[model samples]
Target chain A: MTTDFRSNVAQALKQDAVQTHFRTVVDRLRAHRQAALAGDAAFEQLRNRCAAIRADAIRRLPQLLEQFESKAQRNGIQVHWAETTLQANRIVLDIMQRHRATFLVKGKSMVSEEMGVNAFLQSHGIDCLETDLGEFIVQLAGEKPAHIIVPAIHKNRREIAHLMHGHFSELPYSEDIETLAQSARHFMRDKFHAASVGLTGVNFMVAETGTLCLVENEGNGRMCSTVPPVHIAVTGIEKVIARLDDLPPLLNLLTRSATGQPITAYVNMINSPRRPDDKDGPDEVHLILLDNGRSRIAGDPELLKTLHCIRCGACINHCPVYRQIGGHAYGTVIPGPIGAILEPQKQGLDAATGELPQASTLCGACAEVCPVRIPIPAIINRLRWESVRKNQQSQNSRPVVPGAGSRRRPLEAAIWKIWAWCCSHPGIYNRLTKLATRLRNRLPAGMGAWTVARKAPKPARSTLHESLRTMDIDHE
Target chain B: MNDARKAILDRLRLSQYPDSTPVKCDDQNDPVDPVLWPDERIDCFINRMRAVRTEVHDASHDSWLDILHGVCQARSLNNLLVSPHTRRGAMIYAAARRFPALKNYSQSIEDWKSELFTAVDAAVTSAYGGIAETGTVILWPDAREPRTLSLVPPIHIVLLEKNRIYNNLAEAMRIQNWAMIGMPSNVILLSGPSKSADIEQTMTYGVHGPKELIVILM
Candidate 1:
């Protein structure tokens, strides 16, 4: 519930395992991304195409959604619309209840996490199983997803092995990565077979053809979509694109940026539910278009560019702040620089996400590597400004404003205020400098956190202004 | 549902850029239909696919069945699930007769889906074509070659026609003209075997789907 990032960062850093895991995972991803894009001639051109398509799609979203809905309906796929997470969950549950679905196999859908779909469905007496290995590991461990692409990136192999060993006799405490994968595969494969319905996230919906694309390196996405009698895809309204031609560049950018793969192992373009003549594929396919705070962002000119994000996660991989603490510290469904800005947009600077804007070093790496060219740092700064401005009215005559960086250390603000005042009034400034030189030995103490990492340079006995004046007097 | 749809669309419309003017992307930037020299495409396709641990075999239509037999024999595997409705599946059924050691499963896609999950060792399906740029094998699966044939079993063997290669995904889709007509119910592009690096960033093959993907280029 808390996005008190400073404390979370401190705690995360204290865990040697956490630090090591982040370092290893981010480093590998960084290298992989670099290699994947290295010498790819079409990268920049394709990036431009992707950006253009997103802009176009957002501009014409209503039309595209309408077209997609009609086309999908024609394809015999049922489409549902949800205005909020609660409504979206209800829609999914109603579908499940109608189907008499007991257990569900799920692909990795960040939107599902946003809606708390699993918890909601489970609470309503339907079991939803996460088929993605990372998701499964994290789900069994009773933790929320930590990263967007690799949810269990925070967990080391030994930790994963332990979690699996506790649950399955097949594992019997094997730490080998391959052995662990086999055990999980054996364990989840049956669930896929038994589950009557599959739920997945849509990477992009090609409006022209009414195709829903799900990209994945593991076959779980394919399994979840194909094996089940019923399939439901949950996606935000922002995921739609204008045409099938827009897919190549977007897919290229996504795969390269997310996992540094030339392509995911499988990319399923679901055009419809199983055709009457088709043998395998979902007999009933449903798509839930959820608009939980995204339409407002889309309408906003300043913040609308954020929707251009393909969720490639390159920004997260390249973010210095994200690399330091990993994703879970942010306490949002999506984490890192993207999450920091996006969460505050959905939930205005409240206690839960109030500090997210301040959690950055403002390093522009996230922007540099952002395939969609989102100015993330700019957005975070805007959120910070809004937070501070909002706090101003609340903190009437206070030394510092609440919900602002200056408020955390009011003494620092007071000192700076005094300095500004003295500088404004030359007579007082001269007097203070002379006094400071006179009593240089007896200055204030306890800078606290600042003095911990940084050495305080003792202010020279004579101020720079005083020294300059003394030299001028001597020359005269 | 309709009420929700209208409400969501209205909210989106309200928030949209005031001008209805769409962002104009350069038409010049649009990638054209690709045409590559056959040798160049084949080489590019093989290297890209193999880079991701895919086993790519270059074969003629005459030698493809022999190559398939060799692969199955090398693995000492049996119980292959083939979509008998497909031309490639029929070819496999005919070819598999020579080897009494091999057992073929051809139940209807749903009837044997459970066996495809548990008992089936390998499954072969006919691919629609190949994408040379990313080394992807495209499958427009139907009742004949159902989607599960390529997904469920531990090993997936796809029979891809060589001349059907497209330089990139966009070109392939444009040529397919799915939007103009109608798209297949499921158009899948498989690049390699199922892989996961979720545990310790260690890449492991065959997490939930096929462990091995062998693409036979004919």
Candidate 2:
């Protein structure tokens, strides 16, 4: 409920156990990614190809989505479109209502988290269960997913064991990782079978072939989509790829970048509902394409690159700010460099989530390791500008991000205006600097928040012109 | 709902870049170099599979059944879910007395959900092909071998034909003409047994799917 970014960061920094967990897991993930890509000579070219593929998909998103809809329908897969999160949730609810399904089982899907499907369904008198081991652990603890890929990365084994024991009282208390996993597996198997509707997120939607590709190490995704009679897939509109062949390189980059695996345990490609002649599979397949501010993001050429993200969480792994404060501190669905750029755009600049862009130190590690090579730092810089711009309208006739000038303040604007004037006028600038230098020691040691974690700046003893004159250097 | 679709499409259409050209990505130019695997394709496949803790057994076309029997005995399996209609499935059925009790996945999931989830100890299915570059097995689940055979059971035993092995996924898809023939309802590229690193980043097997993946590579 707390929307303030600074307080959330401070609160997160105070939790010693959480901070330690973040540092340990992120370091391991970074090392894993490094070792995975160490000997691959063609990694850079592969990144370029993947970037081009995603960029092309975003550029032709409308056409590809239309084509995908037609082809998916041809394959007997029902397609639904939602302009907002509520609409997306309603689509899922409608499907569940049609089947009279009171319980829904879910695979690991960040999109479902974005749609707040669980909370919505439960409020409407339905049971929604998260079946992924990590997600199940987080759900048992009554918490949100901290990390996208590893939902329980913020919790160590002992904490997880405690939570599991509390929920599954029949299972004996044990801190062993494998034992805990088995306990959850035994518990969720019944849920997976009894649930009538299952929902999952699409990793990549191939437009030409009408196929949904999902990559996961655990088979819960397969179970959720295959075991249930009704399967619903939710995804942001940006996940489409132009061709089926584009999947191999993207899949290679995604697994390697996210975890140090040459390939995950399973790469499931679901094309349609079970044919009438088929033995066992989902009887109904529903695809819900949620356009929650994505089209607005696609309106801007530079910001359209945000949609190219594969959600590998590599940027989150490499982010220094995220390593310190962890994911919850950001108070957003996604955290780290990608989230810093993406959430601000998705939620607009005036919203509390607008402060996410400033959370980064502009470290380039994220872009350096991005599988699709999204220039995250550069996008953060653009968002920073967009947040504080004086005019809400952009100069290039492109639509400005919502709440464009909400961060601008009269005092800050006046200070920058004075600084600009001082730099433009030589005589006045020289006089002001000389005057300031003579009284340098009189300046206050504290300069507001700037001096909280840093020393205040003082004018030099002499101007550069004066020093140059004494040293006999040439002057313009 | 149509209004929502129209609104989204209209907003996206406005954002289309003028003079957009079709992106060209040459599949032949893919960077997963074949030189990375200098050894024979089967060797690379076996090595990669073993790296991820997958059990790979070498067998001739005639000896694969013996290997399957040995695997079942070693694990002391009670029952194996299979599609007795496949060629290998037919072979297993013809020599049924030598192996454990077999269960067929011929019934609809709604009718067989309870037994399939509780009673099946392992599953045996025919892999359409294998990828040597990443050591993945391709399963085009159909009317005979349903998608859940490799998924719902604790143990998954695959019968792979040696001749069907390809260098990588792209090669497998291209040579198989997947785009031209169209994709099946479910196509899985399974590399290893089901596992997860979600608990403090610790790797644990059999979280929700097969705990053991035995490949009889012939």
Candidate 3:
């Protein structure tokens, strides 16, 4: 029943424990609802400013990128560009080869996962270690992140105890969170001090200054960037903000939305490395700005706002569908409401992970809680249309499986067809509605799929059409 | 070696002036406060250090010492380590005289590894200055002050002068680089406490960094 960290979509769908954990998270969301709603007005204002900043950056992206490259190069930092995941991985590996790095210490970075940096390094006999505790757990379990922020939210303490026991047989089983944390701390301390190269993700890149912002809750991020001889940061180009002054509002909104904290625990801005008079810091710093289909989203009016996402995972925590299926079902580096829409755009709607768009119920909860106010359900619906288009394109000349082919998902098709029919014939619809109202109590159980989890509301005794007719308001 | 040096500078996009002579110091007053800059100007330069979650208060007053003592007691233990900044060391010592329970261990970064790192509960150093827009404290590295002293300790207390605070990060850098005549290799701007949200996204404090930070303004 437990949600195995390494499980794929098919395996996650069958896990009952994951289902129950999601239900619990959804049930507890009411506790945060009041506070979140109160913060909405302030969040909206911040989102508007953030959008302006990003829009401006996008317009000047190329020039800013060139400036950053120039400045970084002048500061002795090697700047690299990768148009695809393969190229990014190769570039990082190339650096490792140049440094003859045996040990790779990683700070928390979703972009690296998107590029499959760990697998690439490990395959080449490089020892890559995750310094972030949540990432370390999933790394140990050989799994992709389930939640963007809290990667192991679906897990209980006992499950972690079991995982730790299996990994460290000498250690005793303990349900205490602190004890488990200490165990991870002890395991990673030596790895960090010994690493030759460190990989990190950039929260924001300053266009004017060419400074890479490293925001985290722990000091490991600092250590990763400073202790290692070579430090590499992987980031999507959309993370760039135009000016340094714009950082505060983004920082404020990101922290409050992500963990309900007023400010981040650590916001380290490194312009360059140790000076001649300086004591300790990385000898070399490299930044790789990735443009892997982000430009396509920037041009689309409907998808443009998706780029405003700070990846705080606030919407994920509040999503009804996400709380049920968890992050694994989305099958992308980022999961939940945001990922469902973004995955298809970045990887194509016909990509093997097409089922992601269908995961949501159009509950409107994610949109309500999203700090940036991305109409997630609307985007998911668009992705569904895109999926349908792709399916139809591939459907040409394929042999139909007799009557079963036409009848596949018949109940769903029939419901849509009926709704379309009702809209077309108002007179017939009115008559049908009145008849249904009279027979509401006598209806059969399980009248629709909705009945599986919720009871159908009792129909009104009479339709508004009937009242209008009685009042002589309209005859047309 | 000469060829390597030229290659390095060429790669860095810097101009090598072999014929240029080093500017000789004209004033015999003090090289530490070079260029005949006033104490007020130096004070203004020191104002760059600002608090993150906490506010910076000048240590020139008596009540400020009480606040420091209160913070020391609240943290449950205290044996302080400070730089050779006479003003900073004096403030702590005066506070200790009032609150005998508190103890002091003052040493510069040169003596960091052997003297300060092992002995102190809190390592207090003067911030080179602060960037107001970023809420970052700038600490310059010196023989008497290694970067490890600021990082390795669990609690970091920084002494910053009010006049040294800059309006934005750009100004802070412009002033700093101008003061040094060239940008130093290390410039660190810290926003808040040292923390990590890595464990199941549950944030815990003091993860491989200082657990606590206190800034003293003068």
* TM-scores for all predictions: 0.90, 0.97, 0.73
> Model 1: which residue pairs collide?
A299-B15
lDDT (tens digit, per residue) of candidate 1 on A183-294: 8888888888888889999999988778899999888888888888899999999999987878888898899998888789889899888776776788899999998878
Poorly placed runs, candidate 3 (over 4 Å): A1-43, A169-173, A389-471, B1-122, B128-147, B162-193, B196-203, B212-218
Winner of 2 and 3 under TM-score: 2
Q: With candidate 1 superimposed using the best TM-score fit, by how many Å does residue A110's alpha carbon deviate from the native?
A: 0.6
TM-score ranking from best to worst?
2, 1, 3
The TM-score measured for candidate 3 stands at: 0.73
> Which candidate model has the greater TM-score, 1 or 2?
2
Candidate 2 lDDT over residue span A1-476, tens digit each: 24599999989999998899889998998899999889778898999899889988898899999998999999999999999999999999999999999999999999999999999999999988998989988999898888888899899999989998888789999999999989988988998888889999999999999999998888989999998899999999999998988899899999989988889999999999989888777999999999999999999888888999999999999898999899988888988899888888989889999989898888798999898889899999998888888783546765358888788889988999999999999999989989998999999999888998999999999988888888998566
The ten-residue window of minimal lDDT in model 2 chain A covers: A391-400
Residue A212: error of model 2 in Å? Answer: 0.6
Q: At residue A352, give the lDDT of candidate 1.
A: 68
Compose the digit string of candidate 3's lDDT tens values, residues B1-218.
23322332232222222343422212232112112234544343334323233435556545666766766677765466554445756666655554424333333333344343345577666778765544567776453455565676678877676667665444565566532343344445565556654443444556666767777666
Instruction: List model 3 lDDT by residue over A230-342, tens digit each.
Output: 89989986777766656656676676677665445566676776555455667788887666666556555566567768887778888876766677767689988898777
Candidate 1 DockQ, CA atoms: 0.73
Candidate 1 vs. true structure, TM-score: 0.90
Q: Identify the runs in model 2 with alpha carbons over 4 angstroms from their true place.
A: A1-3, A392-399, B19-24, B27-32, B35-39
The RMSD (Cα, Å) of candidate 2 is: 1.9
**Top-lDDT candidate index:** 2
TM-score of chain A of each: 0.87, 0.97, 0.82
Report the number of clashing residue pairs per model. 1, 0, 23
